[model samples]
Target: MAQAGTAKQPNILFITVDQMRFDCLSIAGHPIVETPNLDELARTGVRFDRAYTATPSCIPARAAIFTGQSPAHHGRTGYEDCVPWRYEETMPGELAKAGYHTQCVGKMHVYPARSLLGFHNVVMHDGYLHHNRMRHNVAAKDHFDQVDDYLVWLRQQVPSADLVDLGLDCNASTVARPWELPERLHPTNWVVSESIDFLRRRDPSKPFFLWMSFVRPHPPFDPPQAFLDLYKDAEIPEPPVGDWAMQEDPMQLGLNPVTDKGLVPKRRLKQAMAAYYALITHLDHQIGRFLQVLNEYGEMNNTIIIFTSDHGEMLGDHHMFRKAVPYEGSARIPFILNDPGNRLGLKRGAVRNEVIELRDIMPTVLDAAGARIPDAVDGRSILELARAGSASPDRQQDASLDSAVQGWRPHLHGEHAYGHLSNHWLTNGKEKYIWFSQTGQEQYFNLEKDPLELHNAVNDAEYADCIVHWRQQLIEELKAREEGYSDGEQLIAGIAPRSTLSFLKA
Candidate 1:
């Protein structure tokens, strides 16, 4: 690895996907999905077994990734569109300042539709954002032609084509279908296509920071026919339905495609799962294509590749279909860091159990580039932990690394402002404690024993003390907040959720 002040810097390839569950990858011991390329990436580097998105949604999760700050610091605790992205320090901005040429290929999801945040240039395509697509009271600048680069290119290829032409609602619907257009024109393929183009056109004088963000496996569960066919005859497992989530009445089982929770028909659910897995497989293949191109450019060995998702999809886990819930299916994300040159002397294929989150990405990127992490940033680099394996006694000889590991928070506090489902949770990766703000309902899970969160052990005597400990930690975490969620003595429920906090709005 280049030293902090060295002239040569490593290239950063930051890849992000939308609403992909942590268990979707084959490397993660998933039963159905096959992700050979991702598996290879994990084997060549480190895969974090317990990584999470502090704010489990697109807008806020990405906010943490770019700013290296927690949800409280960033002031976006939930999913909301049209909020302006105003931050002085960002991962790309810091990298650009350190002389890295920065570029983003897909899905900025920032407001005004064209806000670059920090990249030198962005090829933007935030798929099916209702705020941008609204016909009424929409500005010309927010129009598709004005903001979406992929839409413009698609129009040139097929005059009448649009993202929603396949008749699937981006967020609300889980209906699955094969891509109607050629596989090359699919948005997933376009991301890689544009990224490869950037590699070809980039100036060779400076190292580059490229963000390849894919807006798939989110919804509209459409994979190309070839990818979809991979799961056509396969036996798909039913989504885990916790006793706590069981609905006695069949009528209560959601019939609407837009429902966020409630059981759907078995056949329909299976189809959705098949399509979702297919999309992941399709993305894996495209990533493989991009890796081949990067190697061809001779940049693969010298570059740092970090693959993660903004958040996870519920995929009917505990009868929840979307994100913003505090469950593992929605909050946990897949995080794999590949340093092909072994620049940091990291333990290859090591699976670290330390609880990490999206906030850590910025610091990690800056650390790899030998750039200065801003004082305002709240996240710490995981490089030391990667170097020493875990903070276990044998690996604590290095005083600095030991101090860093000891200072690591015992638990991560995560929340999302999703109205009735709005919740705050605390976890150290092995166990989780969740408190729903609206109802004050509590849930406790021993993730080591029940990875799928199939059983809620809140009322069990075995975990009572553990629950109390986590609850107090959450109180300390929220007491200083403007929302009055915690009064220092106890939690105060029934506070109306705010997607963007007061400071952010100002």
Candidate 2:
């Protein structure tokens, strides 16, 4: 019999896309992108309109998904390398211990590159790692030969094939062009192909967890020629320019991170966005193919499907390019949960507006598998919030978890350690207050009135009190962190917080 308080184990299919914007789907009212397959998922399940990545960067955001802990608790405050992940508690570790066959098909960006967390096996393909592939490193030449499964297959398919032959830079977020290679050979297609192959090779008796992570809608902006043609004549809207974005050239402003998008040309932005949207459409079609395979195998009935992103790209919003800042373009993400068997009693196609975070993924997966969440976990299970009368016997961590499940997530704190202009944000889904920790500049936006963040009302008399309240809230939040961001009353900038917590042993 299944353990008490645990429902029958259901197959969990968690899908993630890297650096995708929130409004890229047709269902989300996007003007250009048409993601019919993703829209179908939203139509059949619950879509969260206010989901966020607590730490809006690659490594920190992914760590929250794995450990069920906030960036501060997990000890990875920002993007870092060689930070050994030795956590005894992890999402897959808990699920694997509960007898589920967990496997990750793509993009496990963990240090050591091949660390499985707790997965029994992984068909590895993390798109790019600047740290591992450093030209000066001794193992640089042999890096792919030793660690990359996708590259091995690519070479076998076409011995002369090179990622550079397509004239794309994996790290550059600038250009947009039609994919020079065949559609079937694209990285996005390869991830789906491998995931389908896994379903064919799995042990049918055990409930399974599959992570199909995609690397596109990210950089180099190359979609297959057909997808590009689909949007070639579409009327893509101009990006909503902010009141403060008249002169965005970070070069002119002397911004420390020179890669800032303040000065990108108008023509380039249009091409980049066009290609970005096409990639989403292509990705959506691949997902549709994946779903068709699952249906053919008769596994969709009992499986719980989830779709989300690691973090959002700015996509030229507010004159920003990549993540690491606290704007909605960089922090907000798409979160959809399709419970095919209606295990949670949540109304189908319901739009849940409560604030959600990536940290919540671990406990939610554990709860689905009849596995107990540990006291060390800081994230709450969304399922706990949907069902009533679920309370913990212990009140210590229960108090924190209740806030989310009970719809009491009044505030979510976020930050990033950029070189010259570090920033932090506090939001309640309806409004936002941003603080430039280094420069002491503040930006306030009422998302209810201005979803585009066109105006900054920090100095407006109408919102002076609202600004004061969020500022104090930030002060209290930083007091809880080890960074010493504030005194009891006021913020104290310039105290550098360590990337990895000192307590974490390698």
Candidate 3:
């Protein structure tokens, strides 16, 4: 007989979908995509509509999630075009030590994409897919242009020369679909297959922490024939602010390079959005299969299932096709948590509007699994929200938690190091402030009325006090991080370069 007090330790099924935006799901109210599995998952779990990625790119966002630290502190500034070889503390490292069988499959985007970080097993997958250093030549780069190892394996199935016409395109193609070509393989399918294989052979005695990541609905918009056909008659909604010519923001004005149509005409926007949604629907179908396997093995009831994306794809929103902007379309990411224990007595189907970030995920997972959370994990766990009705349960802490000054932090900060120098943001409650170092431009928005953030109130004299407060928040936050460093600690943490450390110490 199971003791009532002996807490049931739930297995964690952590799935990360690359570049999936917040509004891409059918349940999230996307007008085009048919995401049945994601919809179902949303129905049974908490949907964090306002969850933001601390950094909205590949390597930096991933490092933040794994290590539970802000990118400013992690030192993975941006997508550096190479593998990050640094051994940093990771969530799986704590879980693995605590006896969970940790495994990672698919695109982690962490340099190498093969770093164990903390996972006991890692099935290395795609790293740099969209980037091409070569100038285009008349000869089309054949089947294996990106993700070299994957293309090499595809060649073993058929002669490389035979699959030459099926060359991979890193950029989304409006002219053609690569499916008819023989060597093209969907990265999402490869991730799902790897996950299924691992689950098939997983030991039943020990619980598991599986980080199943998929790279799709990311770009190159190459969804298979079946999924594309499924959305043939579907109506894709025109975004509320699709026309860039009418926009006032300089960021919006400067993003003319993202569109496949060069200038985004309304008709082309609809077609492109439909194609992106089709890829999302296809990704959802694969997730459905993975979930089905868990259910068949009776692991569903004992698993703490989490589904989220690293960041978001603009999909032509704000006239930008890809991410790396401070707009809500690129900054906000989807976050969902479905713990079976919540099914019995805890609150299920909850929606949290409170602001959170990607860094919070590491501590949250560790809290649920009863794993040791390293002191280095700066983000606080949201397990309190599941264990108790509120994120902060005690009367004293709950008061503050429910009020804006609670739970692991009173305010959160974000930074984007690549692109135009950098953009740093800080927000608490309904007030948000952004600062771009390159342009020395500052913007402020009261999210209460201006959720879309169309109007910039930075120059307004009336809101000067509010701007000052948020600016202080950002400065104080950065200063706090700076204070955490010491001569000895900085050297051991590898924060100071070898040459600089020696000179400074001397």
Candidate 4:
């Protein structure tokens, strides 16, 4: 076993899936997707059930994950063309400072889409592929449909495949798109290939950190025939559907008619679902390849691998197709920590139902790497939990850290500012409070009783006090964080959340 600082530090391999939901993994008990590689990692690592993204949007969430700060603190809330590197502390930057070789591949969504904050090397593959022509100077020529590349190649590989067009974009009908698929085509396969090459070719003397961010199971809902066929007749379950704000609380907001209501129809739901599952399986296969390379190099035992998604996807959940909501389907993400040497108390096949957030990852990796846990980090390290390989030590240590790090927030906070709308979420674990002044609506949900968030409880007089109490708690918590409290305790007790002002906070 490798002890921190006594010998060479272990290499860190962080893999993040773009817009992958919590329920997409087999290890998380999703009956459909065959995620054998992820299951193996979970079986040999610690899995966090209540893990959440601080801000569940694309660019903002990615910014927060790498910075160890919230979107509110970093100021990259919306789809800005370029990230302002001056205001953030990215993971690679810190690792590079500590003498580690840092590198990143695949979808980073850092806006301008090319901001290399601090990685020693960044080989970007794909990022923030939105189809809005008017949003910026987007050229139709530069936009290469990833699905087309995969489909064309699959056809040549397997000649007699019966695949009908599942119409999504106007481009889906056009066959003019090239058909010959290169070996290094699909974003997942391409990224994984680069990742494997790095693992196999890196110098053993210097420790390395690689961020293999996969941009799949996201959208365009396009996967090749083989993957699409994997779940062809596999009856997949559907997300819950009920009355508007039925299980919602009064504090929630923006219950639009098009979205945040219910599904469109059964046929379309099934088609979209099939495509989503196909993409997931394709991405899964690539992940397995990346792992196979690690095993081949005999580095699987000494390397620490962590797998998670930037944020959850709301594939037809709560009447939503994409993300930017506070529902469990959109907020919760799969967080797996696999350290083979039991470096952080990680036990093979142990799962923990602890609540954690993206902010925790920076400190956790830094702790595992024997790098300094910067004073600026606001998250608690899960190193203790990984060290003992169970919840017992984590629970005991959590007790000592609660006053400083472990208590459930009286209100969890989230924000979104995109497409002419600003949305925010505040929750107290069991109940969620949302206020969207633009739509003049509030939504609340007893998440514990209504796990699907089917009913709204905000307007009910019975839960009136609960609303006020949680709202006040939100204000206090926000104030404390703003006041410079790393974990909203004594660290920054003197600084108030409201006092720290950025345009994003508004």
Per-residue accuracy of model 4 over 1-506 as CA lDDT, tens digit each: 23443337788899888778888888788888888878878887777766787667666677667777766666664444332345456678777776677888777665444467878777665533444222454442233233223333445665642122332342121111111244255556768877887876676667788999877666555667677777767797876753563344253322321243343455555666776777777787888888777888877776788888878866656556466666777777888888876555555665555566787788778877877766777666765554443454453443433433345333457755534234456765567776542453567888778877787788889889987776555555445433232353212222222312365435
Candidate 3 lDDT by residue in tens digits, 160-239: 63222534344442322424532135667667777888888886667888998877776666667777777656766655
Better of 1 and 4 by lDDT: 1
lDDT of each: 0.88, 0.80, 0.65, 0.63
Order the numbered candidates by lDDT, best leading: 1, 2, 3, 4
Clashing residue pairs in candidate 1 (N, C-alpha, C atoms within 3 angstroms): none
Candidate rank order under TM-score: 1, 2, 3, 4
lDDT of 2 by residue, 84-119 (tens): 778888888888888788899888888777788999
**Which candidate comes out best when scored by lDDT?**
1
Instruction: List the candidate 4 regions with Cα displacement exceeding 4 Å.
Output: 1-7, 128-184, 245-263, 386-411, 418-421, 477-506
Q: For residues 134-225, what per-residue lDDT tens digits would candidate 1 score against the true structure?
A: 76745434866578899999999999788889888787534688899999999999999999999999978889999999999888899999
Best by TM-score: 1
- Pitting candidate 3 against candidate 4, the one with the higher TM-score is 3
- Score every model by TM-score: 0.96, 0.92, 0.81, 0.79
